[model samples]
Target: MDTVAANGTGGDVTAKIAGVQALLRGLTILDVLADSPDGLASLADIAARTGLSPSTAHRLLSTLVERGYAGREPGSKGYVIGHRVVHFSTSVRRRTSDLRRLVRSHLEAITAETGETSNLVVLDGKNVVYIDQVEGTHALRMVPGIGSIFPAYTSASAKAILAYQVDDAQLDAVFTAEPRIKLAAHTLADRRDFVAALTAVVKHGYAVEESELAEGVSCIAAPIRGRNGVALGAISVPGPTQRVLEPAPERLGVLLKKHALHVSQALGFRQLSCAAG
Candidate 1:
């Protein structure tokens, strides 16, 4: 308040405004460098992208590099995000609670839209952990006590993420990690069928669990990917099987994918764009 009071005059205000402008310019340079290919940017490229003069861009880039938000490439003259920035990024991502907080609002929105139970599930070790959920409007709903753990193969939420398994080795590891007791009609008949089913989930863009975990309960889920295109987690909407089947489960699948993408984007997930040949 004292600073503002002293700076209330026109000249002082102008000086303060100029200082703010300089700070914004420095941050803009960092943004450009962070998004560039290989996370490196040249001064000319930064100036072109930010529309700042060569001198102004260089001064701000220097400030950022000195402050550890950015750095110079070892061999080349290009700029990249500094160690401090990478440290903060990894620290935030390592906290499961931070991710839950970021996704809670989206879970609420999903429940509001679909009027069914909405959940955010993360793959913890071999089991899927329910970190967050929103109660739906329906009187009868799947209200599992929060923090419940379910096998990855039995629930749609985990299946959606496991569907993107890159190789048989990883799939086999997950299977070995989690014991699978054959549940006659619900469980996949064999490893071959399970692998084939997961491939179908990836191709279908979503996963469906029809009375797999609990009788009369069904769910549709989609994998949420991070900016690096890694599967971070999955979101799901589960309700009674009869209602899920009627009026087309595919419609719910579409809506689930839309919300899942929103959550993924909130987590700094970006879809890869294919360039025209």
Candidate 2:
């Protein structure tokens, strides 16, 4: 027994080494699949990329597919990253939870003051996704449901973040990836017009939308900046166009900016005024 444990021929030791090697090979396959431009790879391509035998690659890939880490692309027979991996990519969900905790009071205050539904949103890919909301007290209001997604260009919340982005390439990418569409009569469908709108957002220190996303609805939003001064997300108040655009758009814009700046400061973005002293 002692000699068996010393590494000559121990079943448990051999099993442990084999398990680790299999785990490593499986991870290598996953990396190759993820690195594909379209997130797909044929079995032959995966085997060649991983430098594994065809039989070994097939076995590992079969296990991966069975376990949901990979799946076959429809009609392609090529392995693609699975829904499980896509779900894992949303680890931002965890970060958003922390963000909601940090910003919930701000959302509530916006709702209380504006009598409009307030939302916390973050840019995901080329879209803005609502993660949290505080409903208005009024019977008539608009609340883009949590987990709702909207084109970045068509959303005031997304424009708030895009207006502060220092990377022009990112803005260009959004246009290149998705064709501009007229979601409503006032939608900024042309790239040049969209860019100008974002520029105005920066100049005005906030963003607004009047029936651009949905008819009879309007929104005002301000960016929440990170330590580097890039927007991490936005705080927005959206409501019936009559209420949101009535009284004064600037009034809502100013209120949103004040609270958004506070949230940005809480998140470690030091304003020039605060940094100067």
Candidate 3:
């Protein structure tokens, strides 16, 4: 031991080992909590699941909570994954292939259910670019191939995303770039009309357009939200006006909103009003 100290690495090695052990134990606790059926676990549940003594679990949990990696369930003795964890997850998913794969399933589901083209779009300044698509089964279906770009204010998908994601300053910037680009008779004419349309999207939780972007095309879309309730992008179903608009647009809007919420949740988004657990 004296020789080990003389080498000046005895305490350093011991501390590193201790730190590694603590990290493993902490990660174990997180895994236990994550695998909980409803994302809620009590102290005893965590201890038993992690194979740690209750005292040890409690001490670790206290530290985790302080660091915002864990949170207490309001009105109960349960624990939940904290917003910080979700934020980290969202950030990673946004930039990786994981988000596209995760969203692909929902897009396929929407196309199957609606018999219309489903698209995944992300905002790029004043434009919304199509990143992925699940073509409709119908031979005459509308398919905006991947990488298609459109003015944000004219497309249902773009409006749905911008409504939840943009602020007044952002809107001003958008208008400054493209004041108006009328594509059809029903296209919104100016900034005031576009802003009003966006406001309606916020109230309805979706957006719809009838031949606003292309002749005889219609679309309904919902924002894919993040943990902070801001839009990450949008999911949309686009098809012929005859099929999409013959039945009120609200009907399709409801379906789009439902699947969009599922995708958002899969991305670890949770409404602030919801209980932590």
The prediction achieving the highest TM-score against the true structure is: 2
Task: Report how far residue 48 has shifted in candidate 1, in Å.
Answer: 69
How much lDDT does candidate 1 score? 0.72
Better of 2 and 3 by lDDT: 2
- Give the per-residue lDDT of model 1 (tens digit) for 146-237: 55556566677777877654445545655664235454358653567666667667776778888776677788888887765556788888
Per-residue lDDT of candidate 2, residues 1-277 (tens digit): 5889777679888898999999999987876675453457899988887889999999999999999988989898799877676565466667678778888999988888767889998987666777888988889878656755566767888778888776876577567643455767788767787888887788878998988877787889999888778888999888888888788888899989899888888888887843210
RMSD of each: 20.1, 10.7, 19.3
| Best-performing candidate as measured by lDDT | 2
lDDT of 3 by residue, 1-277 (tens): 6988999899899999999988888877766665453568899988987778999999999989999989999999999878776665555446746668878988989888878889888876666667778999898987757655566767888778778753566566567652354768788758888878887888888988888877888888888887767788889888888888776887788888888888889878875553321
Candidate 1 collision pairs: 227-269
Predictions in order: lDDT: 0.72, 0.80, 0.78
- Residue pairs clashing in model 3 are none
RMSD versus native structure for model 2: 10.7
Pull out the clashing pairs in model 2.
none
TM-score of each: 0.60, 0.66, 0.62
Better of 2 and 3 by TM-score: 2
